[model samples]
Target chain A: MNTADIKNEKSVRYHGVGISNGCVSGPLRFFRQRRKMGRIRACGDQREERARFEQALLRTREQLDTLQRRAIREIGKKEAEIFEIHAMMLEDEDFLEAVQGALDDGACAETAVERAAEKHAQALRSLGDPYLSARAEDLHDVATQLLRQLSGERPDGDLSTEREPYILVADDLSPSETVTMEKSMILGFVTFGGTPNSHTSILARAMGIPALVGVGAVSEDCDGAYALLDAAEGTLTVSPDAEERCAFEEKQREVNDLAREHDRYLRSLINKPAITRSGRKILIYANVGEGREIAQALLNGADGVGLLRSEFLYLSMDRYPTEDELFASYHDVVQSMQGKRIVIRTLDIGADKQIPYFALPQEENPALGFRGVRICLAREEIFKTQLRAILRASAYGNVSVMVPMIVSEDEVRACRVILNECMEELEREGKKFDHGIEFGIMIETPAAAIMSDEIAREVDFFSVGTNDLTQYTLAADRQNPLVERICEENREPILRLIEMAAEAIHRHDGWIGICGELAADLHLTQRFIDLGIDELSVSVPYLLGVREKVTECK
Target chain B: MKEFTYTIEDPNGMHARPAGKLATYAKQFDADIRVHAGEKESDGKRLLALMSLGATCGTELHFIISGSDEEAACEQLERFCRESWGRGE
Candidate 1:
């Protein structure tokens, strides 16, 4: 099947990766870059040409500033920072000197800017860092804006000029260009080249628009042609015949109706308890990072926060966050939960997650190196400070303290000793805090799960971090793509470990929950329930769906 | 002239954002600041030049400040390195 012929023919189906979720049909318009630049007459004097380049730079700076403000209003601060970086690149000394060098050689302002931009972009590309090398594309984007300002060309990819909403077609859209477009004018997005993880796909998902990427090439002749896009099926049909159009419309109606009904049904289950048909009640909880996510968890009908990673405060600061700062943040989150249990996992850093202030040693195998409980144990002051804060916050609500990467009962005992010390210090200072705060350990390693029978006597409960338990048990790094499938296919060993942990914890009169990717795996929900798992904690979006699945479990 | 040495603490090294920030901050005074990363040297006011050093997290950066305001620049730059660069934020 020839792609070009299909693109130009009637009722041709093109396939690409689908993003977000929706179905729509509208006129298709091709997004083209403005390459035809108007040349300014170069004077015989070098100074005059240099001045012209300076003016374009100034205008480009002003444009970027305006775009930054617009992006902040339309998108968010983090995304808008792209424009801020662009502004800095525009003023880079090396870039300026390169442009000036081109001008001294008597190149016109437009040509000089293009040449300078390419030179810097090339330099960045050769740096061999994937992150920094990606900045090369950003350099080209900034230069394009400067060139457009110099040649007095209209902004590239400005969809606001289009009168009606249309499906957008492009080879690929840069983050800056995508954000600057008039969003209302976009009915959907079609790209000939891009991955599902591209910024265009992320923005499309954020806007809740149908998008198809890597659909090969759609001809410029196809612009303004009526087309139908079904993102759920990852298909874009150009010039759909009457029959195809009718079928597409019916499918679109079904999709829309199904979405609305599903949302309503999930919302209806919000306030109900997730009791299995076998008469076993399971707690449905949310996994959150910080205080900011409490509202989202509440809205999604989470019974409690099962895994509240306490790394957010430490990771964002330039220094060891004071005990008061940590306490205040924890207090707010605890109070917001309104008596619901929130398990605050102590700083699970060192592997993948690094903070510069920690000055952690470079590890040959960080996964097996100093991390989680080991780091907390080595740095007793940091551990004590965090423990003190969590204990103080427990006064306001139902709070549980969970330690990660515990491979032995000795580590649990050490943590308990420090926890006790902190409690004594809090009492001495007359700080009102809950005396009976629940303590727990994450069964994330094979050793921890195997020894759970003994460790269960130390902590109040166990929440299996299946992500690590799977990796550690199978001896495969899940982050390695080649070995990832092994971890997925080898869930039996992980489930068996969870079973061991569940049985051990129950024997000790303690409860067990799962707070990993496996927790939200609906396919394993019934199996987990059969193994006597008592709780499932997932991210906020999956809370309602998991709740519904729990009721279906026998 | 006043001089000081500080080690890079950011896992990302001297990437564009921090380099740009350092350059912007260096433009405040009449003193001339130079950063030496082993055999490579870069003007403290030049973002691209600083990034070109490709200094990784543990690389030491030697700073030399010279001019009429060398005293103030040295004190502030040392403070900046301790507070900002040391934390790598």
Candidate 2:
């Protein structure tokens, strides 16, 4: 069909899995599978052999280096670091030996490199460590690039076809790859492999892209066939009929209208407080991880930072950040807030976030073990360093120290004792600080929430970490898709805990803040407001929506 | 090396706002001036690089001047990083 005819054509029956959000009317563009290069032939002449090997190595390094630099520059430092492992692998003696061995065996360079990579990959896979297993994709990417370069094949450019309104179908997409795609032309994304916790999924959510992953053969089956993706339902249709398309289009239009209305509402409240008609004010803060996020949060009209995860400072560093390193970080955050209250949570690393330098032993149940205040208590020196840094920064701006995962009064008291010691030490050093800095505890565990009244009397504030609260209360892993129904935020127990926690804090004349997904939930915003949450801290993207909801709550 | 003070005009001060401003301006000059706040000192060019200094508003900090355009660089930086007269509480 001609371009004009296709633009006007409404009856073309094409099907594919939906990958991103929004609806667009345009011609379909299919992604071609990456071609694999075959083995290289062995050269009898040593000179030719050496030249070919060096050329291959240089070419592979250039491609990998370019990808790494681009990833770092465009995506982020974390995503860029993923390529460093591949770069190291290329220089490994063992890997080079394997490639050489393949060349010696009369195999083509492409086949030799692929064979070497496959063998090493098998060995790595057998080791079975999650950290190492995650590197498997890196290994694959490097090997593929080497093979393609050696075999004289050009590396594929980003999926930048001109066909508009195409649903991207893939086996899996890295965060960098996802960012490279034409966001406007891409309607949605469907993948055969990915988890909700995956960075790809997180980015998709941030971009308001509707993505369905773990759908087997959906991509292949629906290629060139029109399909409907129901992201809310996590379903992908293949070769959907006219009725289905019409229904989805209608639904998309409804969503668009709502979003437009939301945008208008958000624009109206750009400089306004999240106060109801009854004159009740709600402090809408932003949950920040890095320094860059602070600017984004303030721009989105956040009153201040509700939760500044200090883990990023340590995570981004190669080793444990020295006292000075920690001090600099805290100072940056405090200055960024510009006199606005910033509740800095001490390193809550454990479970999914592991620091290699600390060498924390693996726990049978990381969620319930050796994390948050527990880890801080055991590592007093590290904890003290963080506290000192926080105290030192407090002089610069409004800063508060928050303890995470406090399951008992003793843990809270123990943390307070250490914080007091840090304060004393800072006093001895003749440093200026907010001696009466507000202290808070993250009510993540049910035990902590149930005993909120007791904890509230000791601390100045409480921040509900609903992500962990739901996981702990429901005893369902948030990462597990099968247990998703059980781990819903609107569950009766969750609401009850939130209500009780808010009440307990209010009884003590202490404020309660929520720094979790539930805090940003528009549907539950009014309910939370009614429950008497003093503050709602959410991702920067959802700040406007939450602020609008707060205004409508009365 | 010469040391001078400047008022931070940006609302957020030396953290993200003034640091970004400093980074941009520093990149334009041939000489480098290291902005110091607390124990942190950052090369005046990079945004993430300059923010590493952690300078807050109303805080008097030292800027070590060296390099080719050190005199002009210090004057501009001191003016920017310090609070203006009657501006501070």
TM-score of chain A of each: 0.63, 0.62
Name the 10 consecutive residues with the lowest summed lDDT in model 2 chain B: B80-89
Task: Give Cα-based local distance difference scores for all models.
Answer: 0.84, 0.71
Task: Give the alpha carbon lDDT tens digit for every residue of A1-554 in model 2.
Answer: 01111223343333333344445332223455473566446555655665676797887776666566445433443455445546656665567788889778776666667887887766544545433333445456677766666678764545675555766777666543554565656767766666554445655665676776666544243456666666655655555557767887898677656755756768779679899767899999988867877887887788999998888788777787888898888898899887899999998988645777888888888887788888899989999988998999999999989999898888899999999999898899999889889999999999999998888888999999998999999999864423554676446798899888899989999999999878877888888888998999987777888898888887
lDDT of 1 at A52: 66
Task: Indicate the residue-level lDDT of B42 in model 1.
Answer: 91
Candidate 1 TM-score restricted to chain A = 0.63
Q: Give the residue spans of candidate 1 off by over 4 A.
A: A1-258, B1-89
Please give the TM-score of chain B in predicted model 1: 0.91
Off by over 4 Å in 2: A1-174, A179-264, B1-89
Chain B TM-score of model 2, please? 0.70
lDDT of 1 at A39: 65
